[model samples]
Target chain A: MIEPFNVYAARLLPSQELFAQGHRACQGCGPALALRYLLKALGPETIVANATGCMEIISSSWPETAWGVPWIHVAFENAAAVASGVEAGSKALRRKGRIPDKKPTVVAIAGDGGTFDIGLQALSGALERGHDFIYLCYDNEAYMNTGIQRSSGTPFGAATTTSPAGSKSFGQKTWKKDLAAIGVAHHIPYVATASIAYPFDFVEKVKKAAAVEGPALIHVFAPCPTGWRTPSNLTVRLARLAVQTGMFPLYEVENGKYHMSVDLPFLKPLDDYLKPQGRYRHLTKDVIAVLKKGIDQRYNEILEKCEANHE
Target chain B: MAKAAPQSLRKGIEVSISMAEAAMQANVDVVAAYPITPQTHIVEHLSELVADGRLDAEFVPVESEHSAMSACCGSSASGARTYTATSSQGLALMHEILYIASALRLPIVMAVANRALSGPISIWNDHGDIMAERDTGWIQVFVENGQEAYDMTFHAFRVAEDHGVLLPYMINFDGFILSHVIEPIVYWSQELVDQYIGLYEPMLRLDTKNPITMGPVGIPDIYLETRKAHDFVLRESKATIVKAWDEMEKLVGRRYRPIETYKTDGARILLLTMGGVSETAMTAVDALREAGLPVGLVRIRLWRPFPFEELYEAVKDCEVLGVVDRCLSTGGPGGPVASEIKGALYHKDKRPKVVEFIAGIGGRDVRVEDFQDMAKKTLSVADGAPLPPFELVGVRE
Candidate 1:
């Protein structure tokens, strides 16, 4: 069973929209919405270092920008490293009395490819160094900005342009890399997984990450209509279904302890989540069964962690 | 009114340590670097300075040279006086970000302990690293000795941070040749350095109160224009570069120039070089002069804007110019610097007969005799003796 949207918490969210509209994001872009909620949680006193990806391109076209707060986009693979510099620079300036003493939150934003693949070393270095910053990886599952190429974050049996579903092939060969678990392994103060469908919950996690004293990482599951071959308006529904089917779990790891943010007694059917997206249309019953088994095992492991944390 | 020489200390210090002390004197806000051979001592000493509270800055010991440059881009973008150091492979790793730093007009000062790039993997002194970055839009300068390297650190920061010239700067000194060798350096007091460099007041920065977007996507319509603007700023920055050097000379009484000539009066042959090799080349010119050969030496200090006028003025009267390059262009012209020199003098009416010599590669010692050999070969070529397109000096068959 899954809980409905909490009206009380939704009303408590900050009203200011830091991520302005009139941008070039695709219709119903889940990552755009996630960024909207993230900036709202972080508020105006934030500096964002974004990696080269869909969000960076869509929001930061030349001579125009949707960011109401200070933002910088450096390159494809060094957002965490750049943000570490920004945080350190800000701290140094404040300590040296160059800038005002107010502590502005520094945020690094990247795509799955930037976080899990090419940028892994920089991300690991930043987290290990414990820079007082937040790193948010918006996972749309593949390199959607580059026309849906396969990435390490692409799930098994899912068809992308590179991982086409065809005869003698089962689409992507490997399971999705558990980035949140990797973040937790860094022994950071905060690590969480979020979904765009749960706006209030996602905002809360961003707030918690902002309040943390050291490195915090939030792996956000964002659905891409263009990449997934789903209807433009079904981005939010797919994000919710992703969570309900245990495809992505909404949870947080605080200082090595796990707790489920949206605790569900039982997951909905995987068919409900996989059927709407054309990327998984070629999955046979055998492949579906294999994916189901993997999902259940991972979900149970998280449950075990959450239960162990209670003790 | 001339200011009295500020209280100073003369000490024999390693070039790398002196350079680090110069950065501390400049009061850099951030130092992000990775440890690479021949460049390690500079960053290690910087980290020691930060750890010991001698330098009040953020010392980021990044994992790789790529991240080191990337973090420098960030700190510099945030309006901090940023410094970093690297060599051969590390500079190669930073090749991608080097362009971005200049394109975004971030005034980052980087010290490159010049070392040879690898196939057999060398950690010794050469110009291969910085030569590969010749077109990266950074204001590149070559230093001959420890004192020059230390003084140029302040000059680089001042010129790079000039509001009209917000481009990155590279101070290139030969690794191990200059970096590891200890030389007597006259250090400036903190007050003098503070007055010279001043505070780095950035023209633009990431600030919440004044929200701005940096590194925006430049589409086809505007990308060319942005690149043109960057190029224009780099060309125009020569004025600020000269002005800064002149001001430093007024205070320190140590003069510098884009191109410095030695014993060139009434000379028919000239040897051209950059970095520490110029010192050796000068000795060879003295020997040639004693032997009744009208030979002279010309050293390039500023490399980026190319200093075509200064170079032409220095060598137009000479009959033969032996251009000594420390790195090869490999299969095409045999030498990068010699090729550029030929190109710079191509249209000149009274240019010398240029001879290219690739020497001192991968830390191979280029002695005074080697330079003399290059001059004699150049003189032969000038006298219509046939020779190869270019010669690689001191190479075993």
Candidate 2:
């Protein structure tokens, strides 16, 4: 059973909300909840380079902002690039005795559109430079802010506005881009995959990323209830189902070594994850088999990497 | 590092290398760049400086011109004195971020080694690149020679970072004409450079202690007003721009102006030009005067927040103002500068008839005789002879 909002607050997050109330985000926004947890772990001594997305639009509509820490929205892309500047600039200032405080942790926050596609070059550059920053990609599947257009991170067969199901075709013919694997290939100090369902796990990953000396990235599985056509309250539930069904594995890769943080040897059936979300409602039995096969292949790959790490 | 030579002591240095040294002297905090032709030498030397520990700056070698400008925006908003350099195609690639940099009020100083835009893909000198970015809301200035290129770079940082006029500035010089030329430059001491360009105090930056939001989305209710405010600031920055030039003059004894005139006093005909072409036209004007023609020269230095009053004052006394353009505006009445000259004088009670002549396009050499011929055509316009709105000088028929 899901905990009540009043009781969950004390357990899931701290009493002080760095991402304050009165934000324009829809109720039960998984990305907003993830943001709240990330901010709680990062604390107020963090400067965020926010890419333009749902979070940017909802938080900084105008004169009002929900962020308690210093934040900047550069463009739809280039959050990692902007965070690179922040990290480099602050380091120079701190070395020159200009910045008084222990250098503020720089973090870049963007939706999947910003991370996996349009912003890939900047992200790659920043990661290669090894700038001391944390980049968070809230994987909400599609371009939700611009009305649910399909992005490179949209899963195979997911029904997006641009990738709608038709009479003879399944939606979203392409698979999601493996952004985490790309980050790992950069040989960065830290890279992890987290889910909104597990707030403590995500928060711990955020804390570890902040403590790392070099660049780090967290690919967060933040579900979009509005875009996915699911009930608002099931956002967290869908995130949990995603990890449990082996569709989205919960893992961390530190210094090119993989560690399965939440390994479920006995994974639940894929329909348990797909049936709850309306995006997968159009899938026929044949399409479901294909999706399950793909998930099994990816899970096997992850299992091999984990075993290789142990060896 | 060695101490800089005094003003009397001249050092022959490559113009691009001098620009890199000028940025170093200004004590820049960050440099983000992607190299293109004619602009590569500048960033190449800057990379060497950072590598040698002569300059304590973060040199970010970005992947593309878009990322270059984007990173500069980031570092500038992060409270760092940021700089970048690019040429023709690179400038075109950075066009979008240019407006955003100005709108966000980041005081980033960039050097543009002006080169012609492509269809045929020429890597030569022209104003097509910077002219293409005319309305990007940056404080744009053109340089005539290596000395001006080095000096204006120092002035650009001061003008751009002024709290009253927090806007990005671009110092443009001809690609090979100035960037590749080695000239005698009086390098200013680091002390003098530091004194002139004081420590930057950003109006708003990323800080943990005092949280702030920058570059927020402006919706319909406030979009027009925000754009209005941005326009007003660019317009009102003229005073600060002049003030910055004035201080540079006092410090280095080198004067600059928006509209610089040569022998225009009591002149009946004026040949107006910009960038390195202005110096060439000045030589032609002197020869034409010796040949008993009342020909003068006017150089447009500031291209943005255009000095309408100063320009009118400079050319109003002349009978015909012949404008030389190195870039085409395409389907307009004339090239960009010539059109602007006509527009500036449109409301005046007594104004010179502006003659638009395009020349030296795509690095074609514009000889002194070319200027003489242009002057003759311009004088014909003053005599009420029929002429097209603009003419391409020395183009093959």
Candidate 3:
């Protein structure tokens, strides 16, 4: 039996150490923490195909790797395909009495740039092939690597390199892509959006995704200090504000059923999630209000879907 | 009866094809490729074979050229002996992953109906596509006709999967010139194909039980060393390629050599080319010999590890060489072949003054007259006359 869910009380850290501390992860890098929590849920049986991103570079440097189990660092775009190969390869090897384990979890770690952009095709192929694997996209709202160039995942009205605030204003004119919705459209066994702000919800989704027999996608809203332009300490707080305000929802889809994991009692203003991030520092109040309009539209859409799915 | 048997009679149909029939006869697991002009006939025939249950294969109808190659990569990487084909822009679109295929050393083989690259969008014959991808680290083989195309695709699997190599190979044919043009070809029986090529049970795969990661990135410090390992394997695999060919000959009754020599016993001039263009040089060589000129023709098959030792022996008796590179290097001296031959012959005790020509770019059809002119130009260069420098043929713009 478990106690009534409280963020502090729900914290049940695992005994097995799949992610070692003192290994490089940016100060409060959400993806790194996501990795930590994901590993906790997965225990030591998971093998990760970590893509090239802020977390991969910082943690898996030359001297040593933060990963405690079997790991591979493939190129940026082929993480999903590589993971598919690993899953298929491992199965064949085991059946032939080559590898000892009868079953092992395979997961692919991709960033916003990798998942939303360059790696989309490979992801689609693996998912369509119905490969047994979990693909996690740590969305920090922009391409944090390469000094934060604008990616398709970057939010509207935010100033990025390509979408900078100029005389024309409205730094990024395009709204953030509804990646979780797109995942749902894949008709996968499981598709969910999880935020680091709610670690327990995120971990539950990870465990669910890992257990599914076919393709599963977990879209995690991560906060970056360098790209988000927030202070290191404010990363988690901002992520919390994001979910609390409904700007980033904590939800899941198990075989096409939509369910909200985090039930926020009181919603905060969207600016609380936006204010500390340097990526959106240039946005005027008017622009922020417009962004709120888009977020409202999205939340309404998600709510309607939840209603429709339940009915 | 002994007199009627004739001195040296070889039946044309008794010769095995190097391209089309190998996959069908081998009962390949998958054959997924888009039909781009010349290569279409090959796959069309292959498709019919699969439909007829002659070849046990999954002919996946993919979305595009990229998907076709991607499907091959996925299928082959998953322990299936997969086959695919492309030419020119189709090849160009797969450029990004071509490197990946070789780097992963996936042992996938593709037939390129060697069409020219686009811009003007010509659909004729040229080495434009294959030449551009020379350094892609694939064991590239240029066949003179349809026969070699069928043979090499079969041998490619053996040579590629030979744990010593484990690299992908590309068999190049001069698009419509050879790919669409067919001749009587002997089909190897399935049992013989099995005995010759052997069954490839993969040593590694993507499985659930023994989980392992494939295609990992090595950071800067180890990147160069990794590249060096790939290069060394590519070089060392040359011996294995030859050995595979010799074994193939015993079963199929046709032998293969990297560099082929024709009438060069005491020749002074050697005419060189690849693909269907070799026949043109052979014609020009006959004419040169008719005119009492000491000329020979050396046709190159493998272009990647570059049959250096074999080429040296082939051209050792020659003084002046005429090299035709259908694709442009675009910079430095002239065509790619001209530069390669120069490098190979640089330290020789007695070397030939190789005259290079860039011909048939963008599928400008090269005629027999062009070869005759090429041979005449070679003789002019040999005679120390002011050569029209190494010219780019059929250029009007």
Candidate 4:
């Protein structure tokens, strides 16, 4: 197995961490790593409008804040709307010669619960208006802040507190929502899916999204060891397995054209991605086969779209 | 039949259009809202103004009222003069952000065209909508007619952006009664509006150069202080609200007060009213006066911060205080306004005998006769008659 730190560290962007250390995030937190990479890519010239989630709680607990850049946390479901305001307001002020500095790169950050579920309307509204901002949905799969509850982003056969496995029923009966595809359907300028395990690719995508004129979305696959009931050290390993298994593919859509960035000649087995997490321990061999088939079909669809783009 | 040209209409201007003109005159930077009945005309005209060269602002047609307010919060936090127009259900939908806006101290001005709440759903005029948000901590004021609506829009922008008060303002006008009606209104000159509103200087905003965290979680140890500070500022903002009104009076030569009293001197009966009903109640007072009854009117202009002192000063000398409420509190002592009046006068040494009358609910028209009848019932209550908690006026039974 290739070591991620040794391969990615030599070519890292910078050592200045805008999402600084000494915060209260859980041990081996994957979303924190994603936030760290994003902030480092955007730098301090950014203003973040964050929704209420695990990041908001752990970052700014009181007089203490993990963020070195400007940040605001509104309600649970309006980060995109709030970011729209920030972008529009800055434009108005600059047009009137009120502010001396250039408009900051406005970013809206939210958890999967805030993005794929409650915050979808606000996100859709902001995107349709063509606000110059980037909406980053850090997908941790479940509602980790309020405990392990099943969200719309939760994969099928995963057991959350709300979607517990029983004698007659599976854990989560629904498939994971295709949030990135939904974002692409809005006809936005750019929409991409990246994971924290691949920091260089994630940072490059963030830089690309920031350069886009219209609205852009970057859906990040942020693993949660606490929520997934996995070992603390296996956080990065699980994220890599997810991508290598083709369960969470890395792709980008620019101007409605699909382009695959990380294509594997052979995807690892789905059981390698699921067997480590205690949340999926109850899955039967039959259920695993069905899940593998679903993942393969989705991967094939992405490949077909990529092929069509070239044609 | 061909529709008549707008300029050829009998009335000078529609209230909704004039309110939008006032927003343009104030030089608002952003207008974001969803379309709802009665309030739709205001936002539509604003969008037109933005589309034309008249107003240089961004008009966001948000998906819902929740997003409308959320966008306004962002704009205001970015240190812009943000405004939005909404009505009953729209206001209710934005209820969650109403508190957050005030707590964050974002000076966003919102025009709430007051209307009835749903079920037995109706889009007609009523106060039930705003009454439900009585505790959202936003500075709420009720206006009587189109002239007051136009004037209060200017005043709300100034007062909300005041350095001493940095709070969101809600300028409420009755739905259909004031929002849809065409009435002759005095449009202040753009110069006058510019002088009155001056420039909005935000205390804290989203700036890359100077970053500050806003709306952080208030833990148990510090949450109490946050609430106390919010209450202190809201209660103390009475002075700033009065100062803003006084400045408007100075600028326009028209007197305005938190609680405006009419013919209360040497009178024993006082009819308390708010919103558009005050105009009709004034006629009731005139008719009662001709009949040799010493009846008067107490019109409440400010709905929040209670305006306890001004309200008490108006009703202290009256023998009977007839409070008319358009929204029911249901299971409370009386309607919301009457109950608030009762609570305001509870600790006073010299207080009038209060009688509660609930009228104009679900957009039921409150005529001069209804005000007259309400005063008469209150006089009987003052003359040693049994006082029920409240009476529902205009009910078929």
Best by TM-score: 1
Model 2: C-alpha RMSD to truth? 2.3
Cα error of candidate 3 at position A310, Å = 2.7
Report the lDDT tens digits of candidate 4 across residue range A1-311: 34667766756777788898988899999999999999989988999999999999999878888888888887999999999988888888888888875868999999999999999999999999999999999999999999989999999899999999999877998999999899998999999999988888899999999999989999999999999999989998899889999999999999999999897989998888999998999999998888889989998999899989999
Predicted complex 3: CAPRI docking category: incorrect
Q: In model 4, which runs have C-alpha deviations exceeding 4 angstroms?
A: A1-11, B1-11
Best candidate according to DockQ? 1
Interface RMSD, candidates in the order listed? 0.6, 0.9, 5.1, 0.9
Instruction: Give the DockQ (C-alpha) for candidate 4.
Output: 0.77
Q: Sort the predicted structures by lDDT, highest score first.
A: 1, 4, 2, 3
Compute the TM-score of each model's chain A versus the native chain A and list the values.
0.97, 0.96, 0.94, 0.98
DockQ of each: 0.84, 0.75, 0.22, 0.77
Model 1 misplaced stretches (Cα beyond 4 Å): A1-10, B1-6
Cα lDDT tens digits for candidate 2, A221-302? 9999899999998998889989999989989999999999897869899998899889999999999899899988998898
Candidate with the larger lDDT of 3 and 4: 4
Candidate rank order under TM-score: 1, 4, 2, 3
Candidate 3, residue A221: Cα displacement in angstroms equals 1.4
Number of backbone collisions per candidate: 0, 0, 20, 0
Q: Model 3: runs farther than 4 Å from truth?
A: A1-23, A37-51, A55-74, A80-108, A124-133, A166-170, A186-189, A207-214, A254-257, B1-21, B24-80, B201-213
